[model samples]
Target: MVSSFHVDARALALVGSHATCETEHVPETRRRVVAVVGPTAAGKTALSVALCQRIGGEVVNGDAVQLFRGMDIGSAKAEPAERAGVPHHLLDVLDVTQEANVAEFQRDARAAIDAVRSRGATPVLVGGSSLYVRAVLDPLDFPGTDPAVRARWSAELESRGPEALHAVLEERDPQAAAQILPSNGRRIVRALEVVELTGRPFTAAMPGYRSVYDDLVMIGLSVPRDVLDARIEKRVAQMWADGFVEEVRTLRAQGLERSMTASRALGYQQVLAYLRGEIGEHEAIAQTTAGTRKFARRQERMFRKDPRISWLDVDDHALVERAVALASSA
Candidate 1:
């Protein structure tokens, strides 16, 4: 019994190795790369920590929300204690005001994975953001950002509301529009700005979103929708209890704008409204839960579209065992 492998179109182009390369290349596979992806509050952190401990792998973050500092509870980021001494990369490395893109994340994550290999350990990327995970694992592209164009688009967004600008994006870059929510004004505007500046659809210019990483084992943790919804609600409660409001308050004190991605995170947005007396805390919780559920659905859809991912349930032992099996086989 042997595992067969074949080169895909991208790999054929990259390596120029289309001489009838059959599904028979597995025995000579290079190194191993594994990713753990799932929706928010679906035990990504616990599974990741267990995998890291079991496999002596270094963890790299793929979730966009995990990059911002002071976002512990809401991001469901691993606490220092909860990390169980596993070295993690790319989490809590940026301020709420800083911008992080897939291209940058890909570069950084690749370097981190290389470092882990150098240390004779496996590389495990963990997150729910399918786009970011794919950006790292596959050789996909990220559209370049033109500061000037983005500035202009942002001004338009500020004056016209995200819906109006999203309509323009829908006209120019329908694919990007479909992927990025109109409610995600920053991303919507950025996609449209890239298309306008480069005279290309944003997808065509994405340099980091498509790739052919043969050694990668991308695992996705998918919970039942109802179960995930309940988890989201419970996590929101935990987030508030863990001082998520004060975290946003500190960020606000430092002059975080609603436009910043960190400020725009699911729960933070509604909490900001509450802090500003625009809504009550109860309303903030309810709104945040709803927003998280919506985001989770989108995340699930993104992962579903990727055939490379192996879906798994979030059982404690199963998650650890699957990751271990993938890494060991790699």
Candidate 2:
């Protein structure tokens, strides 16, 4: 039986039609940007590397968490040795104390893609961050913000907690609230800010299936739920064994707890809880695995909403070759 997560035939047709339309309208010299996307632990990195080797591409980091300078083991960032001499952009762009803004990332990523193309290399975007990837590919715009209004929401989030603020968001924009996690206070605050600023639903700011890039091809990796669950468990176990706790400890000393964005990443959050004596070590590991599984589902759901992606199973032996062919044709 096919999983609901699989891309439909209509999506495949849309991708084909869009590629043809792009070719006709876009300048012949414009380059195509290839996005390798999937749920966590689905081998997006491996596939991206293979594609790069085949097409002489450079990698553009698409995962939000991997932007931090020192977050290695937890974010599964490709080490210098693992990158195998392929140049990577935006891997260590932010300090742990700094925040990651989607609008800024969009601008930086576009410039990186341009730079790669100028050097006669294909730009391959690889990561599990669904919105970040869309931010690069789609014509999405960020709403303007007032510090005072944002501060007020942040205060409310601190005093009343994220759940309470989320309740208010639910009352104002249920659709947006449904998509933003209650624990994700940073995004909740931003959503409320946009609603107040524009007097519109936060979801209204999201662009449709229109591509900002002249030529863009999105390849999604599909994995069975059971297999992905096992992968998540094993990945989390390896992270712990690789001293993820020690990595977090180093970051915490550098003010990771004070950062709004970096502090809330999957494994880092659970490890912080464990460090605070809120949970046991084993519980932290279990929670990380569970949270990752939940995050994987959200990633799949986000990508599935876009009708332009070509989904392929990760277990297929010819997966790399197939992605290369599709991307080249696109």
The best candidate in terms of lDDT? 2
Model 2 residue runs over 4 Å out of place are: 1-30
Give the alpha carbon lDDT tens digit for every residue of 1-330 in model 2.
112112123311211111111122222323678889989999998888777766767788888888887999999987776676566777766778888788888877887787778876678889787778888888888888899999999999889988999999999999999887777889999999999989999999787787887778889999999999999999999999999999999999999998788998889988999999999999999889988999888888888887889999999999987987877874
TM-score of 2: 0.89
Best-performing candidate as measured by TM-score: 2
* lDDT of model number 1: 0.73
Question: What's each prediction's TM-score?
Answer: 0.85, 0.89
lDDT of 2 at 187: 91
lDDT of 2: 0.81
Find the 10 residues in a row with the least total lDDT in model 2. Answer: 13-22
